[model samples]
Target chain A: MAGFFCLLLVLPLFIQGFYASLLTMTFIYIIAAIGVNILTGFTGLVTVGHGGFFAIGAYTTALMGKYLGVSMLPGLFAGGITAGVVGFLLGIIFLRLSGAFLAIGTLGFAFAIGSILNNWSIFEGREGISLPHNSIAGLKFGDVGLYYFCAITMIFLILFANSLIKSSVGRAFTAVRDSERAAESSGINLRFYKTLSFTISAALTGMAGALFAHHTNYVSSETFGDSWLSVDFLVAVVVGGQASLAGSILGGAFVVLLPYYLSEYRDFAFILKGVVLILVLLFAPAGLSDLLGRLYRKILGKIVRGQSDVSCNLRD
Target chain B: MFAQQLMSGIATGSLYALTAVAIVLIFRNTRTINLAQGDFSMVGAFMALVFFQVLHLSLILAFVATLISVIVLAVLVELLVMRKIRNADWLTLFTATLGVYYILHGVSGWIWGRDTKSFPNIFSVTPVSIGGMLISEAHVINILIAGGIGLLLFLFFKYTRAGIAMRAITDDVEAAQLMGIPVKFVVTLTWAVGGFLAAFAGMLLAPIIYVSPGMMDTVLIKGYVGAVFGGLYSIPGAIVGSLMIGIAENIAGGYLGAQYKVTIAFVMIVLILAFRPRGLMGGQARREV
Candidate 1:
């Protein structure tokens, strides 16, 4: 584990600047994917409107930096808090809605946000808002600096998710997901946990948005107005392996890097993503991580264990 | 002015109502909302363009051809993709449809390019005077056709064995299967019908909204809102709900500026759902063990 941590720490040093920054963007998406995994994967609620919360986060950070000259840290925090509060309120309203209704409600939320941002003049419409240079303690954030910042944030957030999932709260979330009535009968407060899940998920995505704004130094309607962004977030969670932290990492990298590599054929890229998503869901319902895990076990078992044991494990 | 907006709203509402009905039909049979429902219409509109413009077919022939092609596409979607995981959890089913949505969007963009193109209007744009209000001929035709289709569907649902089997399956899938209803066949039929209706709406809307890959997106959302507004299971409810949405949007646009109309409509949906969680006409929630 120490060695793994050391590798994570030193790995970016060897990569080119462009790739490092790309990886940083991947980290930001991974953060959002983790947020999505918690809500949709663990809690069994589907949100196709997370883009609204992300936009809120991005807009908050951009506005803060533009007007108040707030640094990166406070902007991130405020962005998260604002999104979390809005999510909490939405969760309250959504308590009675479930299944398809909730999905519609969330989609409506996204559309409402999109329209507001696109039409409202204070947001500067499509022109977008540019941030002042974000720095902390007189240390300016170059590409490397931003990369380290996002990486460190992701590590801490992952650790937090790991602990949260292992704790009693996580179990309650799972119970709620598996059977809402059963969870309620077992003395779990459905309202609290569901809202809490939404709050945490929205806050995490919000922070990702904040990081995104700082990374790009701009926030605009074009970036956050589309419902497609929400689809992409959900895709990342499912593609990565729903309900698994490791899957979020893999899923985030896949979603971000797939488009990057396919930049030459932009339209084909979408078709390819659709094909990949359908293939994964059809062949590997648990997602790419489960497929990768099985592959890893099979290869490792062949190398380290007797053939008989490997065959026996494979049978199960 | 109010009368004119109401007439126009009803015309657009009729299109939304059709899409909503398609949605309801699929949901009743499959228990999964087809996210690609709108794109089916998008493809249909493009097919109409080909048959009418490229192939130089007569208007009626082109219309018939477009509907048939769309129905086939929906059947293929069911057979190839949805059939494999018909009983999967909601998320899996939803994601699968999302995949189809992307494929349809990408394919249409590739085939047609991204530029918006005009659709040939079946009805001339000459304004007709009714009760001192000027309304376009297309609007009148759209309203009449939608009403006729709605009446036909009502009759079909009330009298047909296949439609009865669909409702039975919606009530209880296992019981319907036990009763020897060909569940899979019925589901496929429902998809075909859904595709037909979606295409019909697309063709009707093409003249108003123009033909493009994304033309059906907003309509889909609004159609969905209409479905939920009337209770997703009820056909009449979808019609009434969609008309309400159409009028509401037009009124909002006329009174509160055109730019914020969509926002107002969405806010109204949220408010309605908040107060009436099951929708105005939705059935009571059954307790699941």
Candidate 2:
């Protein structure tokens, strides 16, 4: 897996411009998916408003870079922090509700964010904001440079997420997800873990938004703040396998690459995506990651059986 | 101006109330939010367009056909998809509805093309003055039709056997089943009725806002907020909540600026949920274990 990712990272350098940009976007989406998975999969809280957080991050980075003359590094950090703080406050207010109510609340939040972005003058309203060139130490990071930066950041985030899920906090999250009452009785602070999950998820998503702003060189209300964007994130998480880290990467790649491959059938893309989501939920509820895991085991089992048969023949 | 705005707000609020009632009915019975509720209305509007505009049917005929088609679609969705995943968790069901939402949206776009279609107004466009206040004939008719439907629904729930059975099932599904009521049929019936209400609201809204694939997005959100604010399971509460939302948004648009109008619904949702999660008229908090 490590070797494959390394190859992917380097392959972009050798690929054409469009493919390179596509791969970079895939990486950015992977980070976003991981962020969503932490909240939805690990904590068992569904949010239809992460798009709002993403927009907040993008706008923050764009505004800071454009107005305050902050470079990309600090701008990205500020964006993440801002989104995280917002998420923390929202989670405190929203996590009290469960199931459908929570989903509706998040949806409303996403719409509210979009409305504000579309109407507010400081944010330039519907016209959107242009991002300054991403730079570090007076060195401008163009397309290739930004791709490398995103890839490295994605790799680090993946590792960090992996370790986080394996830690005590992750266990608490899973416990809360499975049974909140049981988790509470077991001495897990449900509120704390839930809020923590939201914070971490929002921070990562915000960072991805920062990267997206720099890549697109523009931040708009429609792109990041729309409720449909939140649904898209949900689709990616479910398609990849909600519970698995690798699922996020696979889901991100699937989502990003599907449009490219189906560019000719642009009109049918949404229908196809909807069909995929339904089929996956009905047949493979665990998502594509579980299917991949099963396939891997099956192949390994066959290889081992063949080796054993060859050894037995030699012994005879 | 205040009177006119209030009257217009009431007119729009009636539409929201109808949509909310549909949403509340489904949620009460099935425990699913039906995220595709808006798409259902969108499809209904298109169906009406096809009937009235393409087929050149009379207004009443077009309305009836649209309602029938919407009911069939809703029933098919319930039987084919929702029933198959009856035991799935709330989140899975929600996601499934979202998938359905996307499919409906895409199908409408594919069939109707992406452009907005102008719907011929069924009511007179002339304004009628009541004392010093002026109101459009269409607005008056809309309020009357919506109110009439609400009253009819109220009587149906109160007097009809199926409506009584539906209430029983919503109160306790297993208990209702044990009492020999066809639980599955009632659930399906509830969805059909929901479809009817959504279609009716959509047809009414088409003239004011042109029939488009995305026309019901804001309406659905407002309706959902209303339902939640009124308490998800209560019919009367949903209606009252929707009226409040309608009036509030109009006032906000008039005073604060039109841009801030939509944000009012969202802010209301957040504030209401934060302060009272169960909604205004919800009975008791049933904490999920």
Candidate 3:
């Protein structure tokens, strides 16, 4: 809810196309990161195939809009549902694998998705898909409007995620993440929770992908190629702070915005980005959120100290 | 076509095995899945590409130079970048490698453009046909070289003092350290060996695939699949896993359309891991003391 309000205030400022595109990318990433965090950070499962569901959402939307002349409303929802199903199927079948093994397995699925997108002549291969513009509820979206649409969607998802975390189900997920043996001993269904987290994460990521397809009005195999896209999500989730919704947004922004700033420096910037990721991982396992929390406490302490000193002096 | 593709798969599987073994080596020692390993391979192949021109050497000489360069590159990274943070948490090591992944990727891209370049053939040009299919000479040579290296590595690890020290470190890092067995040096050497193997895979692979900064990106996933399927900690497992992946990939490509090839490989990995997280060979769970 706070993030939605934050978006409401900030969406108006990104009137330009480039910044709007950046915001769109940011939310797309935020969706993926949050989805990933659900699996890796919250539930202790690793998946690299969110990109597959992401591609599923993208292609479903693009194909619907392109061929069926469907409205963005239906196309977007269809995209998310399609990806959700894929995630669900994979979860039922392969969620048994945890750790890096699962990570690579899921990535293989992404690779398969990429190849299908590439070789199927109907999908347009490397040339890419052009999409119809989206509008809803008496409003035709310009760059800024669509940016807010994405932002609004992202905020809703984040709040929903927060709510889920607070519920009994959230504790179940945390329990499973900490230890399957213990969770099983405590009467929790380990298989069910693990699979459910993977499914839920897939659905969330698929939703992001659907929004992305509509937002870009363009899609291609390259859009979800290799670990570049997955790595971006990983970097955002890590840099922003895992296990926190705020961290997802901040990480998305940091990963996206930092690049735009670095593009100014050209080639050297790539090296710097890599270095930054490495350094952050090595030194800040708790991520930027911990740093901010520390800073917030320090500022509060100083203010409290000053106010108390004044009151004591007056009393004296 | 079946025979040729089978031979080619076997040959490439050798390269896959080499890469996966390197991954197994590092994972064996540190338990860190070094994503940077592939990028290191890219660096080696790129170094071979650049130095090939400057050294004015034959393809064999270029391969040797590339191997040496990448080994140094690996060792240096281990000593400077990885060693400093050895005691960091797991996520820290994983994330640090992501940094290493990009740093090498960016540096390689900056030095060499994103364009794909071809390499000179390190071996012959004729096709060898045991049956009706055509097996290229390069495939034959690649298989030979990979097999020879695997044997040497196997022997070295089994027989040499340095190799036993290395194995001891993987068995118990702190115990080895207490035994005054130079654990840090072994780790760096492991990275160097990893870098060397990845470079070898790249150098051999350059002729087979195009050379680019991201050339090994997809292959890295395949290698990971192989390593995990074999058991991350098991060398023999990696070898078997790579060959299985190669054969499966070929069969899938033939039976299913090439479009579904990647999907097949991925589905197989996912299926196997889900059923057997310990891999085909199984891994022992050991807690650090």
Candidate 4:
């Protein structure tokens, strides 16, 4: 795992320009995917409106830095904080409903946010807003610098999520997901944990949006808060391994790079995405990470058995 | 002016009501909400275009063909895709429907292209003045057709054996199956009925909005809001709920701005889900836990 991350960190040094930017985008999505996993995988509550939170993060960052003239770091913090606060409130109302109803409600919430962004003059409506170049302490961060920054932040967030999942709160989230009644009987507060999961997930996703704003230097309701983007995020979380951090990274990479490779067939992309999602759900419901884990175990088992056979033959 | 708006609202509400009925039917029988409900209508509109505009078929023949094809498509989706994951959770089933949504949306775009095609009007384009209110012939035809379909459905449910079996399954799937109600067949029939209603609604709406892959998106969202607003489980409730939405949105668009019309549906959805989850005519809320 350490070696794999080292390879990722050094990847930008070997690949420059477009590929580097693409990798940067992948890193951003990886963060967002992990954020989604926390809510959907851990808490067992699917939200099709995380894109709304993502948009809030981006808009907050852009507005703060461009209009309010705040620094990049503060703007990013503000973005995450804003999205977290909103998620905390929305979660209270939305989490009351479960399953399909919740999914539809969140979907409506996303469209509502999109509608607000499109009509509100403060958001510049559909015209969108351009983000200023990010700088801190007299050091300007261009594409290369942004790539490094995103990679480091992604690594840190991954570690944070790893620790979080091992905590008691994480266990409560899993318990709720597995059986809400059982968890409730066992003294887990379903409402509180669910709300907390949403808040944390939104904050992480919002931070990713902040990075996206800085990287792209633009914010638009169509790009950020759209239903398609929400589906894309869900696709990433499901494809990677809903329950695993490693899965999220893999899923994010697949989502970002697959389209780049298949860019030649632009119109077929939607069909391909739909087909891929269906195939993944049917064949590997646990996701690609689980598949990889199984493969690893099989290989290790074969090697150990082969070694044991050789040793027995020599002794005989 | 007020009367004209009211008439138009009722006409549009009729369209939404049909779509809402389709949504409610699928939700009731399959225990799954088909998010692709609107996309099925989009497919129907394109099929109508192929039959009428391309092949030069009669309007009735074209409409029937569109309805049959959409019904086949819906059944195939249930049999091929949904059957495999029958035991999956609501989230999984919902996502599967979303997958269907994407496939239908993409295929329609591929076949019809991205540009909107002008759909031929089924009714005359002339307007008739009634007591100082001028209403288009299309609107009048739309209301009549919607009323006819609604009446037919009501009668079918009330009098038919298949309809009773469907009602049994919706009321209690396990009990219906144990009673030898042919639960699977009834469920498939429910999907067919949903497809029929969606296609009919699409045909009614095509003349006004034009035939495009993306045309039913707003209508679908509004239909969903209406369904939820009325009580997801009740057909009559869905109809009334959709009518209310139609009138409210038309008024909001006229008095406020047209841009805010879509937002009104979203706001209504949130409000309904928050305050009255069971909706106006829905039964008691059953907690999953």
Candidate 5:
């Protein structure tokens, strides 16, 4: 029933322009959360710095558009590539520092990018860069055109992510998360896989950031603030459920919409986040998806039992 | 000019180190960061602000009152809140601390109304001359207070029986529990001490800088940077790490630019963690079981 409602609600998004932008943000957040999920959920690598790659993407697109006179296509790919290279370098060196150290290190990387973005004159020195719409492969997406473009892009990214997880490579990533000690004995190069995950995750995040900068038409250092990065993207996965792509999208939707609907009680917004997150930590740490999954199983079992009882009565 | 910049940075860094040390003390004792440290300090500063404004108490009396209030707040918070989660998972505990942060931010905003208050001038504004290089009174006092706090903590930890017991528990809580130490009680005491340190640092620094509710938000970031750099478990490391980052930031800001100042600590830590994951002084951190 809930799924039916979701489909109904999501249907307008396919037809309307505003709902498209909403899903555009959701898709972007999906990329960021998936990046973080691969590290935290799959590899047990904690990061508070996905925003750094995000900023790198936004900044790259803005810079290319402003200075290089390059179109948004190259700018978007450039954003992902830049973040991917940096993530690869960072992963190769810092992959071994688990838990708190890893969390802090990622934070440091984000802070570093923050400093550069704030200081760099080409990035407009904290005033922020306004992005122009792209002319993609001679097909320009202006105004309402974002609706179809973003929806299709999100579908493709989700499919790609799904395929990646289904491969043996995905299991290898999960193995590292579960137990690196055992994985080492099984010839899994933990360091290599960890780096691969970081790079792949950053690329996705970069793409999302580029889309965001292009969509909103603004890119600034504040967009990558530590608080938002730590709270919104990281918590979205937890709030939505981790290690699942559909859950990632759901998490993205919640993070964006929850704050929007509760904007009237502005202060209550974060207070509610704290409360809900605490509940998630305590009773439903596996996430909304996991909670719903459990309820579904129980209801299904009851239905099966009731049908069986009716059959017995008919047999008698 | 170089010496002056370096000195000022170290002075500020010392404060970060002091706060980081207190945070480390709490983490070591109870395996929690006590997200309320910033709040405890802010509350103390606010208390001092009130004592000075309303009752016209001497600065000395205000400090004493502030310290007492901070300790009391710490105890109440632990008794009412943290004790319930003694056996919680690290992530759950982490979320709990974040809850504390949100609550503190809310309460502080409610009380303070997001205004910056001018703290009394603890020192004269004139620069104190040293070999013709002018050092502001703020810089001098900041360094002296930070150093004094560091020394006082060292003495408290090294010379007292309760301090040794705290150390013992920090090293091995299960063993300390088995050895007849009231480990839970000691953990509470650790929180109290940590609170006192944060409040003291906040008060002393308040007079040097302006007092605002969100002031510690940035300070906390710097303090965490200092803590991580110094090795979260090492008191001396916190001090050394704070000073190191402070100096590096000063040099970086002086040469590289002030816009990049905030990144120095983070950039430093990332490089260091990549090369030295256990931190500069930390023993090998155990991999997750």
Candidate 6:
């Protein structure tokens, strides 16, 4: 684990330019996927419209930079806060809707955000918003610097999320997801936990969006506000392994790197993503994390006992 | 001007009604909100292009071919994708449909490219004077066809065993199974009918809005809003709600800005879901807890 962390820290040194940007994006997506997992995976509330929060975050950062000359750190926090507030309100409004209605309602939210962003002159419409230069405390980050920033933030967020998942609050979220009625009967306060989970998820995704804007140095409705952006986040969460923090890393890497690997047949990548999502849901409901865990256990067991005794599903 | 907007709104609403009905049909029975519903219609519109424009088939032949192909696609989706995870949780089912959505979207974009292609006009574009108000003949045909389809569906549901089975399943899955209603067959039939309606709506909408992979995005949202507005389980409510949405949006566009028109659907969803959780045409309210 120590060696893995070290290698991750120095990964940006080996890769430059395009590969560096890709890695940064992978980190950003992992952050967003973690947020998605908290809501969809842990909290049991699926949001097909997380792209709206992401847009809110990205735009918040971009617009703040453009008008207020706000630096990277402050802009990111502001973005997260703004998105969190929106998520809270939206959570309350959508509290009544569950199942298919909730999914469709969230989908509409993304579309609404997209159209609003598209036509709103403040967003600059199709032209988009560009930052002057993303800097923290007057220290501008180049590709390598940005990559390191994203990596550090991702690591920090992961640790924070891991702890969050282990806490009573996290337990409450899972309880709610497992059975809302049971949770309520047990005095879990479905309203409070659900709204709280949504707020945190939105904030985390917003922060990632802020990072994305800074990394790319641009924000536009075409890229950020598109409904596809929301879908991509959900893809990351599912592909990574819903409800698992480590899965977010795997899912994020998969989402970001798949297109790069399939650059030759770019369109094939989209179909492949859809196929993979369906296949994952059908066969591996636990996602890649479960597969990886099994593989690791099998290998470790073979090495330790000179036999394969892996009989049980670890998740169950 | 007001009358013209109203006429056009009804025409558009009629199409939305089709999509909403398709959505409600699938939702009511299977309890899966197929995100790929709109994409099925997209496939239909594109297939129509293939038969009519590419293969030089006659218009009537193309329409029939497109509907049949879409129905086949819908059934295949039900059997292959939906059936495997038939008893999964709502989140899992929703994600599966989303997967289908992406696959269809990617495949269509891959084949047709990103360009919006104009569909062959099924009705005359020239405005017809009715009571000193000008409305496109295409709009008139659209409304008529939508109404006719609604009537047919009403008859089928009211009389046919299969349709009755679908309603039974929607009401109670276990009870329907106990009654030996061939629940699986009815589910597949629902999907077929859903695909048919979606494709029909797409063909109707094709001439008005040029066909593209993403063309159904807004329509799907509005149709969903309409479905929710007219109780998710009620077919007639879906039709009525969609028609109202179409007219309301058109009026909003004409009086307010076009931007408001796009925003109205989202607002309506929140308002409807907030105020009347069961929708305008009342059905059993979905309670999560």
Q: Which number leads on DockQ? A: 2
Candidate 3 local lDDT, A55-164, one digit each (tens): 88888888887898877667767877788788878887775666666767777777777877887887887788898778775467877777777877877788888888
Q: On a 0 to 1 TM-score scale, where does candidate 2 land against the true structure?
A: 0.96
Error of 6 at A297 (Å): 2.1
RMSD of each: 2.3, 3.6, 4.0, 3.7, 4.4, 2.1
Answer with 2 or 5, whichever has the higher lDDT.
2
Tens digit of lDDT per residue, candidate 6, span A101-173? 6766788888788888888899987899889787889898788888888888888888889899899999999
Clashing residue pairs in candidate 2 (N, C-alpha, C atoms within 3 angstroms):
none
Tens digits of per-residue lDDT, candidate 4, A87-115, equal 89998987677776677788888889989
Q: DockQ: which is higher, 3 or 5?
A: 3
Looking at model 4 chain B, report the run of 10 residues with the lowest lDDT sum.
B280-289
Question: TM-score, chain B only, every model?
Answer: 0.96, 0.97, 0.94, 0.96, 0.93, 0.97
Query: Taking the tens digit of each residue's C-alpha lDDT, what string does model 5 give over A1-316?
Result: 3353346346654566676677667767877788777777777776777888888887888888877767767887898898899889988878777777777677777777777777667766558887765667668886456645555666667767777877878888888887888998999998889999999888878777877888888887667645456556777777777687656777888788877787775456666766776667667767777777777666766778755443221100
Reference-based TM-score of each model = 0.96, 0.96, 0.92, 0.95, 0.89, 0.96
- Model 4 CA lDDT for position B169: 80
Could you give candidate 6's per-residue lDDT for residues B64-160 as a string of tens digits?
Answer: 9999999999999999999999988767777798889888988998998879999878789899998999998988889899999999998888899
Q: Give each prediction's DockQ, rounded to 2 decimals.
A: 0.66, 0.68, 0.64, 0.60, 0.51, 0.67
lDDT of 4 by residue, B192-263 (tens): 898899889888898888888789987988888878865678888889889888888888888898987888
Mind giving the per-residue lDDT tens digits that candidate 2 earns over A199-270? Answer: 999999998888888889898775855687777788889888887888888898878887778777655776
Docking verdict class for candidate 6: medium
Clashing pairs in 6: none
Q: How many backbone clashes does every candidate have?
A: 0, 0, 1, 0, 0, 0
TM-score of 4: 0.95
Candidate 4 chain A has its poorest 10 consecutive residues by lDDT at A307-316
Q: What Cα-based lDDT does every candidate model obtain?
A: 0.87, 0.86, 0.78, 0.84, 0.75, 0.86
Segments of candidate 5 deviating more than 4 angstroms: A1-10, A13-16, A68-74, A134-144, A225-227, A306-316, B33-36, B39-51, B54-62, B72-82, B115-117, B130-133, B207-209, B284-289
What is the Cα-based lDDT of residue A87 in candidate 2? 94
Q: How far is B145's C-alpha from truth in model 6 (Å)?
A: 0.4
lDDT of 5 by residue, B216-271 (tens): 76567677767776567877777888888888888889998786677777778877
Candidate 1 residues lying further than 4 Å off, grouped into runs, are A1-5, A306-316, B284-289
